[model samples]
Each structure stands twice: as C-alpha cells, then as structure tokens.
Target: MAEVLFYHLDRQPLDRVLPGLLEKCLERGWRSVVQLGSEERLEAIDAHLWTWREEGFLPHGTSKDGHAAMQPVWLTAGDDNPNEATVRFVADGAGLPDPAGYQRVVMLFDGNDNDAVDRARAAWKEVKAAGHDTTYWQQSDQGRWERKG
Candidate 1:
C-alpha cells in the first residue's frame, strides 16, 4: 500500500514549504510529480522551483517543457504521471492519483482556509478507508511539521 501523508499548512504558505519537500525527495533519489489545480499555478510553481534560492535547483519540467520522462520532478495541472514518479505531491486541492502507482502521496493543504481543511479531513478519511498507511502532519507553534495523527 502507498503511504499517505497529510500536511496541514498553517505556519507557512505552499511556496515556502514545497521547495524544501521537493529537495528532500531529490535527496532520496525519488522522482516526483507535483500536481496543481491549474496550469497557471503549475507555471508559477515551475518558475519558483528555478529561483527559490540562489544556489539551489530542483530539476523539474512541466508538460509544456516536453520530455516528461526525463525530469526528476514533473509539474502538471493534470493527473498524468508521465515520469513514473514514486512520490506524488498533490497541492492546490488536487485530488489524489492512483495510490498503487506511487510509493508515497503527499497532500498539502492550507490550515487557515476552512474549505481546504475540510477537504483534507475528507481526504484523510477516504485514504484511511482505502487501507493505505496514513499519517497526518501539522505545523507547530514554532513553524515546524509535527506528526499529529
């Protein structure tokens, strides 16, 4: 079963938290697909990954960039996993992809947004019911991720 990780974002925005998470995936030698809600958001994330830091790069490309299979991190607004990624990052309220195809699934939602939080809650229940190994992580008072459930 795929591991489902829920990230409740309160201490920071997705832009602040995403790059670091993607970096960790790279360190583990895992390819990832970051699925957003729309192409505009996907483009924004694509730009951010390139300039998030002065000396850092995440090695990502969107469908518009072509050669999807060659990218370590593939960005898309759709459900396609052209890179055969072992890890999938579902952001901006995007629905989960086929869990069996991924080793891990990460859903990041804004805790400050009521709708986002509610959606995450529903997702957690659905994932758990689907029999995946699930975990819920929330940001602490000091802006650190803590395993809450």
Candidate 2:
C-alpha cells in the first residue's frame, strides 16, 4: 500500500514548504513529481524552485523543459510521471490520481481555505477507505510539522 500524507498548510505557503519536502525526498534517493492544480501553478513552481534560495536549487523541469525523464523533480499540471518518480506531491487543490505506482503521496492543502481543507478531509477518508496507510500532519504552534493522526 502507498503511504499517503496530508499536510495542512497554516504556518507557511506551499512555495516555502514544498522545496524542503522535495529536498527530503531527494535525500532519500527518491525522485518526485509535483502535480499542481493548473498550468500557471506549474509554471510558477518551476520558476520558484529555480530561485527560491540563492545558495541552493531544486533541480526540476516542467513539460516545456524537454528532458522530463532526466529531471530529479518533474513539475506538471497533469497526471504524468515521466520521471518515473517514486513520490508524488499533489498541491494547490490538484486531484490525485491512483497512488499504486508511487511509494508515497503527499497532499498539501491550505488550512485557512475552507474548500482546500474540505477536499483534504475527503481525500483522507478516501485514501484510508481504499486501504492505503494514511497520516495527518499539522503545523504545531512553533511551526514544526507534527503528525496528528
């Protein structure tokens, strides 16, 4: 079964939080595909990952980048894992595809957005009912992630 993780975004925006998560994925030797809700989001994330930090960069590419299979992180607005990624990050209200091929699936939802939170709740139930191992993570008062369920 795939591991499904839900991140309730309260303390930080996705741009700040996502790079760190992707970095962790890289450290574990896992390639990743970040699926966003729109083509604009995919483009924005592609640029953000390029210059989010001055000293570091997350090597990634979108569909326009040509070499999809060579990217360590593939960014897309669609359900395509051209990089053969083992992990998938569903952000910005993007709907998840089947998680069978992925080792881990992360759904990051805005905690302040009622619709996003509601979607996350539904997704959590659906994933669990589908027999996947699911966990809920929320930011603590100190802004650190703590698994709540």
Q: Model 2's lDDT to the true fold?
A: 0.93
- Per-residue lDDT of model 1, residues 1-149, tens digit only: 99999999988999999999999999999999999988889988999999999987779998789898899999999999999899999999798776888999999999899988898888889889999999999888898889988
- TM-score between candidate 2 and the true structure: 0.98
Q: Which regions of candidate 1 deviate over 4 angstroms?
A: none
Q: Which ten residues in a row have the lowest lDDT in candidate 2?
A: 61-70
lDDT of 2 by residue, 27-89 (tens): 998999999999998888999998999998899988788798899899988999999999999
**Which regions of candidate 2 deviate over 4 angstroms?**
none
Going through the candidates in the order shown, the clash numbers are 0, 0
Residue 32, candidate 2: Cα error in Å is 0.2
Pairs of residues at least 3 apart in sequence or in different chains that clash in candidate 2: none
